[model samples]
Target: MINSNDYKIGRIMVGASDDDVRYVHEADNLPYYHIGSVNGISMVTIDVIGHEITHALVKKTAGLIYQYESGALNESIADIMGTMLERYMLPNNWNWTLGEDAVTIRDMRTPEIYSQPSRFEGPGWESPGNCPFPFLGNDYCWVHTNSGVMNKWFHLVSTGGTFNGQNVNAIGPHAAQQIVYWALANYLQSQSTYSDARWSTMAAARDIYGECSNEHRAVIAAWNAVNVISPVCPGSGGRIAAEQIENSAESIMKVYPNPATDFVTIQLFDPITTVDLQLYDMTGKVIKAWNTKESTITFATKGLVPGIYTLKAQTPKGIYTHKVIINQ
Candidate 1:
């Protein structure tokens, strides 16, 4: 069934039957799948075939460009989905590594085995030295190398791990795959970065597992473990005790003097580690910002017009928002 609108099925070809290799290429607005001879040793390995199939899916979904972080993300997604399929089909026989039977192409379990950084603390993405495939016009951009960050993230999310002083509960591969594919198809863009990946995956997990669910929390922890922070995820930066602040009823935050002429006092019912306070006007523009480790902090509203404003407090206990009116 060949349909122009159907990306699942496409033109497939087999070449170099006497050589050991496989690849996928698109030419003239059409994709072609090629398989090479592997000396009849593990020629039918589902893992390798699945890897190529995932590339097709990536091109169809995110259409990720093959450069920089986006390219690395592209390679990571292909490996992720490919390995996931291999594991699902043969749970006991499969392992957290690519190239199941052919000399261990890459190890997803411990990327360091191949000198890939499992965390994002390594070299910067723009480091010219990290660029791979110099002969191919530097199009690789350490795609396979830096992919370890996300590969480790997937492993942690699927199997559970303790990272960055936080414990993540394993939701199994089923949940991980769902959240990952959702992010790839919906949240990720052509130029999305690692931070964007974190946000998208968290959003995907949120949609599947609810904002306050354990799965959603695991998604955040897994990325944080890899030192990948989400710029858009809630309670991201104001982490207390190295964990995101979960909303709790015990630690109640109070704001005094709702109709204040000059200042407002933010008081916490319980002594917490830290708090990020933000004051915004009716237009949602931030009027003031403060980071305090004290139990209470006062925000001055002097030299301001009389109007309604919002005061937001971010703490390890959760996020609290209140309405304040300033009258002169």
Candidate 2:
């Protein structure tokens, strides 16, 4: 039994009478992973195990909703982490193929081989319009299928590649994993889309490697290779600002007592009747939330760990963000 403060995995059942392996979160709030056997062969490989465990990590952190683009991102994260784990365990024999020891479902280096698209809207891409119901069609808006785009992006980022007229310089697997993991943990949200992912990963690379660095450039090129273009150009130092609306003269939102130990307050310049507020940790996990009509709101932060956090407000105009710091 593996246990942690965040979550616990109660069981790992192998040789189940099932066609596919899966990770399940039961009503008791515990996680369980099952490995199935086919033709007397078990699908209990390291990559497969890593894939399922990464699902639990996603739930604990980003909690990305399993539908549409977010769903595809969920699957892609699992695949990326799985491949990284495989490489870590078997450094001498590691390859980009997932489940090579078992079913051989996905090949990150060559996603097209498994009928998955390498670039957005490229051949073999599955459109969400084809599936009216989430349950009836190809893996919930092609979550598994569209994940190939990101898988390909990761592959290119890890080991230099040229695709879709874009060439990405290899950053190697360690740096690539750090940037992607940082983005997943610190920037992404539950309802975040692929565009959001592009921005977040770029921001993560900037945070880690500085602006205009080779690693940052590689991240941009990789995303472009997968056709998930970011509105912000390289070396410009602007990121997804087109999606946000702000006044030139004054800020729309204000957060006070930034490096506070006890409490923090938020005030809006032009208050709407209803605004949604969310506080996220450095790990992108929601800490506190509010839906209120008041322009100024204050909340306690007594028990939170001292770190930098993100405060986001959703208003009628647009979404606004504020950086907060806590010190104990």
Candidate 3:
């Protein structure tokens, strides 16, 4: 049995002394996760850990909303990462489905699965009564509950992992998740809605990989399969500003699967035959450098430590900057 002192979930570690972590054994006949303190604060159940962890990861990265369109993105992403993490990390406890582990939470698969029945509900994903064009066909789905549709979309896109005659093998789940994450965290704007998810994800993929990259192509195809837009999804005024820069000079410098775990694949964004690349730590000391001539470049940052570092690549054209992080 897990105690206040000994339990662990995914990459999160905590002790009873910390108030952010707490569990109650008798609530609803099963212990679950609660947000703040130990008493009167709910329990931290297993899936609750998943959802909470998702929220934490997003907060750390995009710092996206806690409500509305950003909220929907927030909720859906939580389900996607939480479910995926449970499937990958705690295989023994994996359910491969959202909210199935909870009685109070809505089941993402069947919106009708829960009686409250709002499209924005968290437990079950029902079509939102009304949504913008991208989500217009939306079945008024509740944010957390309705998120099942998007979660399923992510699962389908990431893992060749799919349902209902779709090719989920668009990209590796590991790679796809990272692509979507970076897009949401960096590429997406504040006013983005549900439909913007696919665009945001694909933009990130293209930015990380090349526009001609297979991952970008696969992501676009997957979005098409779900009726999501290829570029940016349009909202009320008929269009949004999310656009992939054509011949983006930003594409000249590349980083793959950011939030990287191992070696980061850096490719030359421009064709500078004579160029020097340097990496520096926070103290402004040079740590890694490469001097060579090639339009395509990749780096094996294996020995690099985990933390924030800057990659500066200079060519006859001037200077290019890329921020890189290695995850331990």
Candidate 4:
């Protein structure tokens, strides 16, 4: 659960003429949930209410843009929370299908039943390339459909499962929810991708249960099951490597003091004439920029908030990115 005072639902309008129920922010800038009717039948159910309300929570917290991967993530979070709420309220009648009371829309246990992709870019996956505009595209780049990937991941984390050749040990619903909520509130940024979510949730589990704990391992396994490989955590006997390019082995970039409290050093194995360097926060905001010919640069992390940041370098060969964490 999160701070309710900051994101209180403004109103719940029942019997609206809208085709479907949804959460929206109008001119007042307050969140409102509208329950629509179909042929004089109200579509107000416990899961429906929970789903819409979660949209409000997500908007206030992560503020994920309602398009592409971020939009899919938003939809997935709503579904996951809605299902969890339904289970908590009606344990006897709990089911994985969304809108079971009104209509069977999405199934978290098996999303392919409704033409949703359970695996990333797998069967039933919607391509964003074809849908350029949200208004014209396939449900805003198939947000509802693509959400199945993350939904399945949540299901696996809550209840142990083996998928994509990876086996995960269940962390249970309560622990899974805590890790997810913590990641959304503390680490996730507006433009976060699936890879970012993987990193954020792993970091959250580490913060809550310690590095390489069972819960943290469960998070990693669940992500790997969904085919989203996260950057290796620090002190796990491996360093976070940059994206590889053609002949990238010739120019190796090394970043030290990954979990840094005061400073970090960047050293390039192969010296180049000039390099353009930029540091960015998780929100995709550039924190620092430098254009220098030096191969080794020491950057100060003093006064910076402790969190995940990215260091990017543009050399003659290719662009490289390194993930860094600042510790207070």
RMSD of each: 13.9, 4.8, 11.1, 7.6
Measured against the true structure, the TM-scores of the candidates, in listed sequence, are 0.63, 0.74, 0.52, 0.69
Candidate 2's TM-score: 0.74
| Candidate 4 residue lDDT tens string, 159-203 | 988998988899998788877876777557787778778877876
Model 1: how far residue 276 lies from native, Å: 36
Higher-ranked by lDDT: 1 or 4: 4
User: What tens-digit string does per-residue lDDT give for candidate 3 at 21-136?
Assistant: 42233434443444443433433445656676666556556666544456567777776676667667777776545544433454444334544322223334344345443331
Overall local distance difference test of candidate 1? 0.70
Candidate order (lDDT): 2, 4, 1, 3
Query: lDDT per prediction?
Result: 0.70, 0.79, 0.56, 0.78
Predicted structure with the largest TM-score when compared to the true one = 2
lDDT of model 1 at position 28: 57
Clashes of each: 0, 0, 35, 0
Over 4 Å off, model 2: 4-7, 38-40, 231-328
Spell out the clash pairs found in candidate 2: none
Instruction: Flag regions of model 1 displaced more than 4 Å.
Output: 1-8, 11-23, 26-28, 37-44, 123-139, 231-328
